[model samples]
Target chain A: MTAEPDLDRALVQHLADLARLHLPAERLATVLQNARRIVAAFGALGDLPLESGGDPDLQPVRLRTDTAEPPLPLDQVLANAPRTAGGMFVVPRVVDG
Target chain B: MTELWQLSAAGLADQVRRGSVSARDVVRASLDRIERVDPALHAFVDHRGERALADADAIDGARARGEPLGPLAGVPIGWKDNLVVAGERTSAGSRMLADYRSPFTATALQRLQAAGAVLLGRTNMDEFGMGSSTETSAHGPTRNPWHRDCVPGGSSGGSAAAVAAGLCPLAVGSDTGGSVRQPAALCGVFGLKPTYGRVSRYGLIAYASSLDCVGVLGRSVDDLALWLAATAGVDPADPTSVAAAPTTGAAAPAADLRGVRIGVPWQLNGPGLDDEVLATVQTALATLRELGAELVECSLPSVAHAVPTYYLLAMAEAASNLARYDGVRYGARRGEGTSCDAMTTASRSRGFGDEVQLRILLGTFALSVGYQDRYYGQAIRARELLRSDFARAFAACDLLVSPTSPVPAFPLGSRIDDPLAMYLCDALTVPASLAGLPALSQPCGYTAAGLPIGLQWTAPAFGEDRLLQVAGAFAAATDHHSRRPPA
Candidate 1:
C-alpha cells in the first residue's frame, strides 16, 4: 500500500484535542515526522488479511459479570476528592447544571 | 549473628528459624543498607523505615514467643512503585499519580506482608513502565550499581539496581516484555518472569494486561525462589490468575540434568550480539553440558516478528489502561475549564511525558476502526505463530537459552532518540513474553569492557519450577551472581 504523503494535520490536531494534549508549535514538525513513521510502520500491517472468518486476533478477555454493588460512603468518596463543595465534587462548570 | 543484609532470603529465614539471627536484626540491617546505597542508586522512591522496623520488631517478638513464622519472616523486599500499597504513594513513575495513594493494597503485596516480609520501600520504574531505561521516570533515572554512568535495564531498573546494590535482598518487578529480565541482566543480578497468570495482577498498574507478569529480582536464585513461593498463587480478585500448583522443592540441591535437552535457538544468536555476550553465553552452554544437560540447536522461524507483535499488543493495552488518567478521579488536575474536553486535554497535556504521549497516540491509531485489522489484528496473528514456535521447540528440549540482551547496559541516553533501536533490545526476550512462558536471566559473564552479560533460560508455559531449578543449579555452580560491583 502506498503511504499517504499528505496526512490530515487537522485530524492529528483533532486527536490531540480529544486526548487533551497540547503540542508546542515548534514540536509540530517533529510530531508530524514521527506520525508519518508510525503510519508507515502500521501501514505494513495492511498487507495481512484479517477478515478470515475465524477467531479474532485478540484473545477474548475473561470479563466478570457486571452487577450492582454497594457504593462507597459519601463521606469516604468526598474525602478523596481534591475539591469538594456541598457534598459534591466541585469543578469548573462544564455543563449548565 | 550473621550479617543479615548479606544473606539470601533462604539463609536469612533459616537463621531466624534457628535463632541465629533475630528478625529485628535483619530488618535493621536492610534499613541500614538502604540508608547507605540508596543515596547513590536512587532505587527506592519512598522508604518506610519506621513501619519496617515496627514490623520487624513484631516478627522477632512472635518468634521469641515460639509462634509460627512465615518462610520469609522479617526479610525486607521492595515493591515496584506501580504496585499499589495502601497509604503509600504509588506514583508509577509518573507525575500524574505522584500523590495518588491506593485505598487498598495489591493482593501480591498483601500476601507478601502476610508472609512476614517487611516492605523496604517502593522502587522507581519507567513511567507506567514504558521505557527500556528508567530515565523516563518522573523521578530521575536509577543508576546501575556497577557503573554510575550506566543505566540498569529498566521499567524494573530500580528493583534490579536496588538488589544489586544490596539495598534489598529481593524485590518485585513487572515484566510485560522483558522489563524484569533486562534490568536484571544489566545490573548483573537474577530476575525471573513467572508464567503468565502465575502471580496476580490485580494491583499492578496495567501497562499491557495480557503480557504483564509480576516477576522477582534478587542477588541469588534462592532468594528469588523464596520470594516467588511467598507471592505466587491464584488470587480470586485477579480474574486472569490461574490456579496452578505451587512449586515444592529443596533449595539449591546438587542436581544434574544429564538427560535434559537444552535447545539453543538459532534465531536468538542473531547478528549484532556483542561478541563478549555471545562468548559468555557459549561458555554457559558448555557449563550446562558439563553439568549433564544435552545441548541441541533449534529454530523459532517466527521469532523475528516478536518485537513488532509485542509493541502492537502492549501499546494497544497501554492506551486502554491509561485512559483512566484523564484528570477525572485522581492524579494531576488541570485548571477548571469551560468544558470537560478542555479540562481533560489540559490535564493530560501537563501530566504525561513525551514518550507516553507518543505511545498513546500510536496505540489510538493502531486500535482505531480503519487500522485495527491491519495493525492490531496482524500482530495478534504473529503472536500466535510465536507461541506455537516455542511449543514446538520445547517438545524437543526442556529449555531454550540465549543472550538476554544484545549488549550489556548501553550508556544512558545512547538510544533514546531512536525508538526502534530501543525496542530491539527486547528482541530475544519478547518472544517468551508473547508466548506467556517463564524465563530467567542470570549473570553469566562480563564483557571485555567489564560490563555484565546475562544468559536467558526460557521454558514452556507453567514450567517455572523446571526453569528455576535449572537457573538455581547454574547459579550454584558460578559465583557470577554473588559478585557485586565496587560501590
Candidate 2:
C-alpha cells in the first residue's frame, strides 16, 4: 500500500528469462510481488537530482604484471564439477550436428 | 564456562606461545563450548572440530620445536561460509555450491592461517549476503545469543553470534551493507568493517564486487586489530587490495579522547527510528564527551537515499558477478543432460533461494535495455551524491557516529515476509558501505527488554586507525562491551 509497483506476469517472465532463472508457476506470483515491492522501495533513489560523475572514493584497481604463473592442477580443477570428461567440463551440446 | 575458551584471542596466543597453555587443550575447550551452545544458536553450518584440533596440534608442535610463533599462534577462529578455505566446502549459505570444495583458499584466510589462526568452522549467512536477518540462508537462520526468539542481524549473523556466544574468540565475516556491524550490534559484540580494499578478496564468493569487504567479529577491539595485522595488506591475487599497512594508532587507548570531532548526521533522526536505540546512542555520546570528545551535528541529506542507492548498485553488481554460476564450470547442477540454457536455468532456479532470485531478476530488469537509464544509471548518480555528502560531512568532523541499527534485534520471523521491513533494518548502516568507509559497531547499552544496542563510529577511507583508537578508548572507559548474554 505504500507505493504502487509495476509487476505483471509478462514482466516477470521477461525478467526471469533475462536473469536465466526459472520461476515455477506457483512461486512466480509471490516472487513477482516481492520483486515489485523491493523495486518500488528502492525506487526512492530516483527522486535525487540526477547529475553524472564518478565516485571519487573508488580506489584505482592495481593490476599486477601479467606474468605467466603455474595454473591449478587439472585433477583439482575438475574436483567439484558435476560432469567432466577428457580433462574438461562436459556441458550439454549447444550446436546442432 | 571452559577456562581455556574464556581467554581472549591475544591471551590465548600469548599462553600458547609461552608454553603456558597447549593449543590442543584450547581448541578442545572451544570445540566443547561450540557443542554446548551451538545447538540452540545454529551459528555454524560446518563443524570441523577434529580438523581444528589437528591444526592446533600442528601449532603446538611448531612451538615445541622452537619455531618462531606468529602473532595469532594457536588462536581458533570461525569463517563465514562465503570465504573459501582450500579443500573445504564453501556455499555462501546457498544450495548452489553446497557440495563444492574450494580450489584454493582466499588470500586473507591464507594469511590468517599463516599467522597461526586455527580454523574452527564455516559459519552461516544470508544466501549470497542478500537478506538483513539471515533468514534467507538456505542453512537455517542464526538465532541471537541474547534472546533465542530474536534474530541475529545479518548476513554476517552467524559470525557475530559465534563470537558473542564464545564459540570462538574471533570470527571473520563479510560486510556488504551492514552485514557485519549490524549483527555485531544485535549480538552485543565488536564488529569492524575495515575500509574497502583494506582486506584482499581473492576467493570471497562475491556478493557485490565493489562493495564487499571482509570484516571481523570479536569480543574485544584488540582482536580486530590483531586480525587486521595478520590479514590486511596488498595481495597480488586480489587486484583491488590496497598496499596500506595495518595502522598502528596510539600506543594504547588514551584515558580520554580529547580533540576528536564526531559528527551526528541530522538526517538519521527521522521516523522509523526506535526511541530506545536513539537514547542508547545518545548516552554513549555523553560518555564520549566525558572522555573529551566534541560532538558536531552535521548534515548528509543524500544519506536518506542511501539504502535504495546501495541496494541498487549491489544488486546490479551481484547480477554480473553471480552470472558465473550457471551449472557450467563449477557448482552443483540440475536438469542433467538437457540443453545448456535449460540446464543453467534449472540449476539456478533451485540453487538460489527466493531472496537471491528476486535480486537477480530485479537487477536484470534494471539493467535491461529499455529500463537501464532509469534504475541502474540513476543509482550510480545517487551513489556519487552520497559519497560527496560523506566528503562534505567528514570535512566538518573527524568521524561520524550513529546507531549501528535503527532498532535492537526483533523477534524472529517478524519481518521475514516483509521485504521493505528487512531492507529498512539496514537504513542507518548502508551509507558508510556506499562510501566505502571504515566503520565499527560496539554494544553501547541494552534496551529495557535486555536486548543489546549498538553505537556505530564511521571514518573516512583509511581512518581505521583513529576510528579504532577512539572506539577502543570508549570501550575501555565503559563496561558495555564486557556485558555478556545470559546462558
Candidate 3:
C-alpha cells in the first residue's frame, strides 16, 4: 500500500500546518497512513476524462428579502465564547504593542 | 396487543387525536423503554423524563382545548445530537462542544417540533458525522438492537437503534454520506436521505455543507413519509433548501410496481459485496419484480470511484465548515498560548477526535495549493461524471436499487482500526448521496445471524414521494419490517 506522491508525511504535515491543526509526530504517522489509503481509494479519478459536464454546485443560494432583522442579543451571542472581555471575544494577542 | 411504545408515529398521532391515548402515556412509555433498553444500547445521550413528559402534557392540553394538532402530535422523536435545539445541549458527539448549548433551534427540528413531535432527547452519532460506525462517538458507541455485540451503523446509529429498539417512533439524523440509510439498514428500520436541498439544514452543524442533509428514521414508512412531508418545504434560513413539489399525499404504498421501472446498476455486484447481503438484495429485487416492476440493467461507471469522490469532497467541505470551531468564540478552549494561532491549533487538536482530525488533514491535503487540481479538482470532475451517469440511467428508468450497506451490522470494533475498510462500507449508499438523489433504505430481510439487511432504492431529485410509495408497497406485501429483536 503505497501512498500517492503527495500523500506523504511532509505533505500531510504541511496540510496540518495550513489547516491550523496541531498534530504530534506519533499522530502524524497514523493520519498520514490513512490519508495515503484515501488517496489510493480515489486515485482512479486521476485518469478520468477531465471533461466536467456537470457541476456538483456544492452550495445553493438562498434568496432573502431585503428586510433587515435584529441580531441576537450581545449577551446571548457572547455566552458561548470561551473568553470575552469588554463586550468582545478575547483571543490571544496577535499584535505586539 | 401493541404496547404504546410499539405504535407507529401515525398510529399514536391518530390515537392521541381521538383521545384514545394520552400524550403523557406515549411519552412515558418511550421514557420507560429508554430506561429499560438504552443502558445497553446507548442510543440516547442527553435526556430528561421531566422535560419530555412536560412537552407531551402540553400536546395533550392542546388536544383537550379543542385545538388542531400537528400531523406528528404526540410522536416521541429523538434529534441527533448535532442538530441544535434552542437551549438543548448539542454535543455533535465531539469533546469540543461537549457542554455547549444552542441559542437557536435547527429549522428541521423546529418544523418537526411545531408539528407536535415530542423531543425524546438527543441521539448519539459518529463525532460530527465522520464514521460509518457509531464507535467514533465521544460519548460511546450505540449498539445494534438485534445483536448487542454489533454496531448500529452510523453516524446516525443512535437514531436508527432508537427506532429499531422501539425507544422512539421517529428520530432525525443528518446524512452527509450514507449516515442515515446505512444505520437504518443495520437496525432493521426505515431511513431516508431526501434529495439534497429537499430538507432545510439551517442549523445542522456543518460536516460537509454541500452534501449534508436532514434525514429521518422510523419504524414505518408512513411515519418517515410524514416526517419528510412536514419538513421538506424551502426555508429562508437555509438557502440550499429548495421549494420542491410536496413529498407525499394520499400516502399509500402502491398496490404493486405495475409500471415502475427499477434500474439495477451492474456496479452492485463485485469483489467488495458480501454474499449474504447480495442474496438478500436479490430476493428483495425479485419481490419487486413479482410486484410487476420492470428491472432494467444500468451502468454507473463513476460510482466505482464514489468512495474517493465522496470522501474527498466531503473532507474538503468539512475542513472549511469546521474552521469556525477555533476556541476564541465558541466551544471549549484547550491551551494557553501567547498567540491566537498557537491557541487555536492546540484547541482544535485537543478538541477533535482522531477521525475528525484525520479527515481535516486529508481534506487540507487535497485542497493544498500544489495538488488542488490533481485531487480536489479531479474529485469534483468525478462528481460531475457521477451525476451525469445518474442522469443517463434515470433517462431509462424511474428508480435505481442497491444494498443500502454492502455488509450487515458488523461486530463492534471490527473496522474501527481500519478507516479504509469502514469507509468502503458506504460504497452502495454513496452513489445516491453524491448524485443528490432521494433514496430510502427499507428492511428487506435478515441474515442467518439475525442482523437486518436493507434493500435500498434511489429516485431522481425530489422523487421522495415515489420512493415512499414503493417502500410502502413492499412493506405492505411483506412482514420483514415488523420483526422485532428478541428481548
Candidate 4:
C-alpha cells in the first residue's frame, strides 16, 4: 500500500451531508473504503507534467439572443410533481415563523 | 431470405422506402426478435410496442402518400433509458425516476423520429450511467449476447446487447467515459462516440456533463453512419451544441489505405492487456498493414492520467447534475413528516444505488472545502495535457488504434463489487473521451474462448467521416464484422 488514507469517519459523514445522502452506517464503511481507494487512485494525476493554461475549459459556451422564448407550460412542468398545490410544487414548510 | 430484423439500418430503410417491406413488418420483426432474445439478456426496460407500431404505420402511410421519405425511414432502433421520449418513462436505469414521464422529447430523438426511425423501446443502463458494468442497473444486468454469463458493458449495456442480439439494427447510448464503446466491444458490434457537441445532449440525462456524449451502437458502419447523419447537427435548444453540417452516409470503403497513417499508441496497449486480446488486435493491425496503411508508434504519456481525470471531473459533474433529483418536483420521494432537506436526503438515500452514491460522495469530497484545487482542479489541468497530447499525436498520424477494452467482457459479477477494477475497464477508452475526439469500436477478432475483441479507432474532433471511412474499409477487407454472435 502506498499509504493509508487520511480520511476518517467524521469526514465521510461530512461528505454525505454535503451531497444530501443519508447512507446507512454499514454502507458508510464500504463508501469509506471505496472513496479512499478512488481518491488515492486520483493521486496518479500528480505524476503527469501538466501545464495549466487558457482556463482549461474545452467546451465553448454559446449565448443565445436576449429575447426570451415561452417556457414549458406550468401544467406540463408540474406533470411529474409528486405533490402540487395551486399550480406550484408542494413541499415541506421551509420556515416556522 | 434475410430476416427483416437482421438487415442493416440503411438496407432495411431502402427496402421499406421501395415498398418491398412495410414499416409495420420491420417493427413487428424487431419486436418479435426482442421477445425471443430479451428474456435472457434483459436489454430493454420497457417495450413500446404499441407506440412503435403506430410510428411505423405512420411512416408507411407517408410512403403511400408519396411524401418524401427521410434517411432513416422505417428503421427500428432502441434508445438508452437515459434519453427522454415524451410520454415514456426514462428511468436512467434507476428507481428514482421509475415513474417519471418525459414532458418533452430529446432533440436528437426528435431528429431521428423525424427521419422515420421507429423507436422500439428504452434500453437498460447502469443507474444514472454510473457503473462500468450493467450490474448497477436497478432493473437488472444486461447479459452479453455472445455468452450468457458474461457482461454486456455499461452504462449502455442494454443498447449494445439489443443490437448484438439482433433485437434492433441500431440503438442510441450515452458515452460518459466508455459506456457506449466498452459495451459495444464486449457485445461485438459497432459503437461510435462522436466529437463532443457533434450530437445534441439536450435530452440525454446528465452524467458528468462535460464528458457525456450521445453515442450510437449498430451492426455495421453504414448503420452507424446512417444514424449519425440523421441525428447530428446544431440544436438551438442545447447551448453547447456546435454548428456543423450533417454528414452524408458512408461511401464504400476504399480499395487500399494509400495515404492513411494509423498510430498504435504504446500507452494504450501495454502490460495488463489480456494476451489473447493483444494478439487479436496485432493480427488486425497486420491486416491494416496489408491494406497499405503505414503503422507508426506514438505515445500519449498523459493517457495514464486519463482515468483519474475522467473520474474526478465526471463525479463532480454528476454530483452537481444529480442534485436535481430532490423529492420536490419528480422521481421517488420519502420522509413524509420531515423538513424538505431531510425528505430530500431520505429520498436520495432510498433512490440512488450504491455506486452512484459513492461517486456523489467522492465528488462532494473533491469539490469540498480546501480540496477542490487538489483534486478537481488538478484533474482539469491533466485533461488539458491529454487533449494536447492527442493534438500532438494527430499531427503525425491520421488515426489511432487500440483495443476498446483491455479484455473482452468480464463475468457479470466479477468487478461489480470492485469499483476501481470496473473503472480500469475504460483504460483505453477514457483518453479519447477526455480529449473530445471522435472514436469508434468495431469487432476486429475473437478470443480463443469465442469472446469478441474490439478494434478501437479514434480521429480528431469532427473527423467522423474519415473515422467511419477507415472502419468501413477495415471491415470490408476482413470478415470479422460479419461473424454474428449466437443469441
TM-score-sorted candidate list, best first:
4, 3, 2, 1
Q: What is the lDDT of residue A5 in candidate 1?
A: 33
Give the TM-score (vs. native) of candidate 3.
0.97
For model 2 the TM-score comes to: 0.96
lDDT-best of 3 and 4: 4
Runs of candidate 1 exceeding 4 Å displacement: A1-8, A38-54, A57-60, A67-79, B249-254
lDDT of 2 by residue, A1-97 (tens): 2333456899889889988998889998898778877887777766656555454334324566799989999999889889999999999998989
The candidate that achieves the highest TM-score relative to the unseen native structure:
4
For model 4, residues B381-474, the per-residue Cα lDDT tens digits are: 8888788899999999999999999988889799999999999999999999988889999999998888889999999989899889999999
Q: Which stretches in model 3 have alpha-carbon errors above 4 Å?
A: A1-3, A55-69
lDDT of 3 by residue, B1-487 (tens): 8799899999999999999999999999999999998998999996758998999999999999999998999899998999998887899999999878789999998888899988889999999999999999999899999999999999999999999999999999989889999999999999999999999998899998778989999999999988987899888888788989886643788999999999999896545788898888888889999999999999998887888889998988888889999998788797776588888888898899999988888888788777777778878888888899999999999999888988999999899989999999899988888888889999999999999999898999998888999999999989999999976
Error of 2 at B468 (Å): 1.0
The clash tally of candidate 2 reads: 0
| Tens digit of per-residue lDDT, candidate 2, span B259-322 | 9999989787545779999888878889989989999999998887788888887888888888
| RMSD for each of the candidates | 2.2, 2.3, 1.9, 1.7
Sorted by lDDT, highest first, which candidate order results? 4, 3, 2, 1
Model 4 misplaced stretches (Cα beyond 4 Å): A1-5, A49-67
Candidate 1 CAPRI-style tier: acceptable
